[model samples]
Target chain A: MILTVTPNPALDLTWHVEALSPGATHRVPTAAARAGGKGLNVARVLHGAGHEVLALATTGGATGAEFTAELAASGVPHRLLAVRAPTRRSAAIVDDRRGETVVLNELGGPLAAEESTALHDSAVQLARDAGVVAICGSLPPGFGAEHLGELVAAIAASGVPVVADTSGPALLAAARAGAHVVKPNREELEQATGRAEPLAGARALLDLGAHLIVVSLGTEGLLVVGRSGAPVHARLPEPLHGNATGAGDAAVAAIAAALATGVDLAADTDAAARARLDLARRATAWSASAVLMPLAGELSPRHAELEAAVVATPIHEESR
Target chain B: MILTVTPNPALDLTWHVEALSPGATHRVPTAAARAGGKGLNVARVLHGAGHEVLALATTGGATGAEFTAELAASGVPHRLLAVRAPTRRSAAIVDDRRGETVVLNELGGPLAAEESTALHDSAVQLARDAGVVAICGSLPPGFGAEHLGELVAAIAASGVPVVADTSGPALLAAARAGAHVVKPNREELEQATGRAEPLAGARALLDLGAHLIVVSLGTEGLLVVGRSGAPVHARLPEPLHGNATGAGDAAVAAIAAALATGVDLAADTDAAARARLDLARRATAWSASAVLMPLAGELSPRHAELEAAVVATPIHEESR
Candidate 1:
């Protein structure tokens, strides 16, 4: 079983607008709400891929209750550590005409010290029971990188492989605490490595005691670096376009699933990379299908066809 | 006492971002959540002016509860009709660099028949006890213009003057029901009267059985029409830069306050118009002041200054 921990979760509200004119009023044609958090999205994608996954997160107030209800409705198993303040909401305004998307995120309120302890306790318990644990997303206010780093250390102490997916200081702290895998996108990788090249960034993270490093390159594909072996590259054939809101989470989900199922580390990295590419393609198709249907549960056959085309390729040193 | 009714109020969430590039992720620097709805805004402005005001609106679900809590925190006197379904939320992403405000509003779910009846019953009770009642804002989903029209008629039947502020079919329906006053902006006026001229539009509503008509001309001023008078034009000095969101509501609030204080109809129109401009100016000042001091009380001084500048001017002839 794969366990995912989201420190700060949100109810993502998306509004579809024709064209966005600044300072001008535009009526929204459609709106949708989904339970969102990096870890929650990872768990959702894992579950969608027929994996056993449990989502653990800290939630509070009315929005928290709504988030829990939405997760239940989506059939995603989750345990919420209730706090005093409300969980923040994130907004995504999709301007279809210009193909632009603007995201507005709230800096969630601080959590109590007791709540932080409770979250750590929950993560420990879940990590002990699961084969792989992924801690993802931004830490809420009042939770410093050191605090999150401690949680990552505690999970690693349980002998479960830990995947830490986050950015900024938290990512730095988690790497110092020795996470098994750290997934950072290209920009984040640059910040982590202080280098523009993917190889240099991946090497920097691995040097920080991360056993493996996966750097997401958006449309460019994924870069993998390991301690014992030379770096491997997994390339996708097509560039996928869509919201890309949950694409990183999908990639983490694939990695967690592959690791738990005993796929070889290099093979798993390749598989995870391809899975992300495929998911991106599928996501784009699903989004297009939604334009025509505007409702869930009505994906076009093209979505499945795109998913089928994703092939995991392992690049060994000899091949390189 | 002046009463304001908002059948479907919302928690207006505004996210201020540097620049919004749609389809790209952005981190918001500032976020604010306030109780919103046309009637609620009117009530807030009235309360700010030290008027005896009671805000009545529906509250339901978690968001509604939060909305009510926020109102309480802000010291706004309100009576919310609790409903089963959650109240809706609207997100506005303001890009200060581009001066664009993109709004995504939820299609607020409809109230049940019983809920609708309860709202009407509450409005009737409030109207019976109040000197003036204003029914404002767009009707929530599942409610037709006729429902609002009937509600206005019910309030008017209580012998208290009823002011209906709305647009589109709802305005026509309310006017046909013989509302004491109808306020429509230029666009709404054009839609209602099929004329671009404010005078023509105000006169059309008067012919449709409205006893008094207030046509808001945004920056120019207001055009007031009554049975005994030809038309009254009230002008306002151009306000400094500010968000004009609640300006119209502030105008309604001022009108109700002036009318309750026994001001003549023409005088009331001019007072309201000037008050609106003042409100716009102060609201802008407050927004800027809020950046330095995040205290709600800090806005009081500006509010008072704006109130002092509110001058009512009567117009004997309409400006071409």
Candidate 2:
């Protein structure tokens, strides 16, 4: 089983309108609301793929109740911790005429000290029997990067591999805490390491004690790097276009699914190298498949065909 | 006591941002949520002025919980009927850089047949002891204009005068049901009566069995017509420029407040004419004062000064 922790979750609302006009009143013809956050998306992808996964997050207030009810309706296995502050909401307005989407995200309120401590303790305990743990999303107010570092260290100490999917200072903290794998998209990697080159950014995470660094390059595909051996790259023959909001989360789900088999990449053997290549191919295909779906936390049924079309290669020489 | 009924109440959320760029994601720095609807705003204005008032509306689902909690915190006396459908929400994005506001309103879900019947029965019973009753706002899905007409007729049957502030066909429905006073903005009046002139529109409403017709003309002040006597016109010495969203509701509040004194305009006596002039002056002043307020359900403290600046006159000749 895999355990997923979402520090900040949202009741995501989407409104469909004819078109968007700034400073004008719009009557939405259709609207939908669901439970959303990076970790929850990851858990949903895994669960849909017939994997056993448990989603953990903190919920409170009226919006929190709505979020919990939505998650339950989705039939996703989950446990929620109660807090005092109301959950934040994110709204997206999809304009059909112009084919544009405008989003508004609320900054979540501060978490109590005890609530943060309780979340950390709960996550560590839940990871005891899991083969791998995935910690995803932004750090909420009052939750410093150091808290994420401590949680990552504690979960890794329990002999379960931890995958950190975050950005900025939190990404560095997770790497320094000895997380087994860290995934950062191209823009996030640049923001965290201040390095325009993806390889240089991946090397920065490796130097911080991370066993593997996977960088998502959008249409360019996936790049995997480690302390030893040449970095691997994977991509499909053509680019797919649809909704790209959940592509990264689906990629992270593929990585977690691969690691749940108790495969140890630190062994540096032929089997480890082959497993790394498989992870890259699967991640690229899953991400592309997600782009074909209209909403997040869903994948196209042609994932196997997409994986078969992927071409993964090892970079023995430096390349841009 | 005055009773206000809002058939389609909303939990209004406001988000403040520096600027708005279509198709871009905005991180709202500040946000606020409160219970809002036309009738509720009227009740709030009356309550703020030390008048005994009760607000009645329907609430359900998560958004309803938040609305109920906020109404409780506001200290406004209210009784809400629960339904299966979630309450609707309206969001406004205030862009400081552009000095503009963008609004998105959700059409409330359908009310169950039993729920609608229950609300009508409850309102009629509650209005039994009220000096005047005010019905405001749009009809929710599954609720037709005939329902509003019936509700108004039922409340008025209990000997409580009904002041209706609504739009479209609902405005005509209320007038046809013998509403004591019906207030509609110039645009709404034109839409409901299919008349280009405000006086003609007011006459149309009066022909439908309404006792009084008050048409708000934005910066042009108000045009009031009734079953007897010449039409009255009221305006401030100078037009005040500010938020005008709640100005009409404030006008309705003033009318309800004046009627709560048990003054009978149907008597057609000299004292009754004097009371109509007073009502016109107060309504114009209160409506202008509301323009200075940033949010609905609030009146400026300078209402007395504004009232002193109003000039009201009776029109004996036909005018546009």
Candidate 3:
């Protein structure tokens, strides 16, 4: 079982219109609402892939109630801790005429201290039997970078591997907590490590005691660095053009799925190294497949074929 | 006290963005949500004017719960009859760059029959003590035109004046019920009566048993016709260029305000005729003042000055 934590989740609403003219009235032909935020997306994808996952988050107010209802309707297992403030809503207006989707994200940085603690406690309890704990997305209001670090340290103490997918100071905090794995996109890694080079930045995370780091490079693929001082790169043969909104989260989902199925990512043996490499290949394939879908937290049906098509290679310690 | 009934109420949301490009992400700098629908708007405006008003509607689900909460926060007295479905949301994305406001209205015509009946029953009961009863906006799903007419007649049975602001079948039904006052914009009046001329259409409504018919002509002013064969036209001397979204609702609010204060619109005496003309003048002034503001259910502070500047003339039957 995998436990996913989304501290600041939202009810994502998408509306479809024929056209958008500012200051004019438009009739929405279609609309959809779903649970959103980094960890929830990962949880959704992982659950969809036949993995047992529980999503934990703090929710309150009307938006929070709607979020809970939607999560229930999705049949996605989740536990919502009641808070005082209302959860946020993210609206995406899909204008098919221009092949554009305009998104409006409400700033959700007001999570109180007590609320954060409540959410953290619930998450830790849910992580007890979980094979992997994936801590994802933004910190709520008053939940600073240091708090994220403390959270990571506490979750990692449960003996369950923790995968931190976040950015900025929070990413650095997770690394310092010895999170089993830290996933950061290129920009996020650079922000955390102050290193322009992806490999160097990932190494920076490794130096902070992280057992593994997957630096997402968008269409360029991923740079996966392991605790044993080895690096593997994986990518599809060709770049696919589609909505890549949740690709990074899908990658985290794949990692959690691998961990749940007994893939030994931390083992230094030859068989373990080979398994870790294969995990990277599969994760990269799942991410690539996700890019072909229109909705986030969902995947394209071609994941199996994409997984078989991923090419991976090992990088020597001193590639220079 | 005035009782306003909005069968198909909604949570109106407005978002301000620098610019809108279809298919792109936009971060809203500001957003506002208000309880909306024709009768609610009238109720809000009347309340703002220091008049006691109660808004009654069917509400349920998360959105409906939020609607009730926002209404409570606004300090407007309201009765929310619980239904099995959620209320709808109407979003307006204001793009200042293009000087445009794009609106997206959800399809909101799927309410259950039992819910509609429940709302109507509560509204009729509340009307007993109300100085004036106003039935406004579209009839919700399963709430037909005949139902609105019956509602108006039932409310009128309490001897309280009933003001109906609606269109097409609802407008015609209200007229047929001998509603104390029926307000319809030019287009709606024409649509209901199948008459190209506003005056002719308004007269047709009077023949249907409406004691008074007000045809809103936007900046051109208002045409007030009574069953006794009198027509009074009132308008601001000059047109104001601004948002006129809820001007009609504002007019209805003014009429309800007049009735709540004991102004008679159906008396056959000369003093009553004079009072009815004054009501028309005040309502037109309120409508004109509303056109200068951005939000609906809100009045400009310059309403008094606008009211004094209204030009009105009573037309004899021969002149028509």
TM-score of each: 0.86, 0.87, 0.79
lDDT measured at residue B150 in model 3 versus the true structure, 0 to 100? 85
What is the TM-score of each candidate's chain B when compared with the real chain B? 0.82, 0.95, 0.92
Minimum summed lDDT over a 10-residue window in model 3 chain A is located at A22-31
Residues B1-320, model 2: lDDT tens digits: 99999999988777777887877677774357889878888999999999999999999888899999999999999999998888898777777677566777788889989998988988999999789999998889867799999999988777799999999999999999999999999989999999988989999998998889889987788977877777889999899876566788899999999889998754467887888888889999999988787677899999999999899999997554
Model 3 clash pairs are A22-B100, A22-B101, A23-B100, A23-B101, A23-B102, A24-B101, A100-B23, A101-B23, A109-A141, A111-A141
Q: Which lDDT value does model 2 have at A214?
A: 92
- For model 2, the superposed segments whose C-alpha errors exceed 4 Å read A29-31, A196-199, A216-244, A263-285, A288-294, A302-320, B29-31, B196-199, B217-247, B263-294, B302-320
- What are the RMSD figures for all models against the true structure? 4.8, 3.6, 5.0
- In candidate 1, position A314 carries an lDDT of 43
lDDT of 3 by residue, B19-65 (tens): 77765556553357788878888998999999989998877677788
- Steric clash pairs (candidate 1): A22-B100, A23-B100, A23-B101, A100-B22, A100-B23, A101-B22, A101-B23
Binned by DockQ into CAPRI classes (incorrect, acceptable, medium, high), candidate 1 is medium
State each candidate's chain A TM-score: 0.84, 0.95, 0.92
Q: What is the lDDT of residue B308 in candidate 2?
A: 91
Maximum-DockQ candidate:
2
Per prediction, fnat is 0.65, 0.73, 0.75
Residue by residue across A1-320, what tens digits does model 3's lDDT show? Answer: 89999887877777877766655567564357788888898989988988889998878777888888889989889888888877877788766666456888676747777877777777777888788899998777677788888878888887888999988888999999989889999988998899999989988998998888888888888988887847899988898766566789999998888777766686788987887788889888888887777777887899999988988888886553
Model 1 residue runs over 4 Å out of place are A29-31, A228-236, A264-304, A307-320, B29-31, B97-100, B227-236, B264-300, B303-320
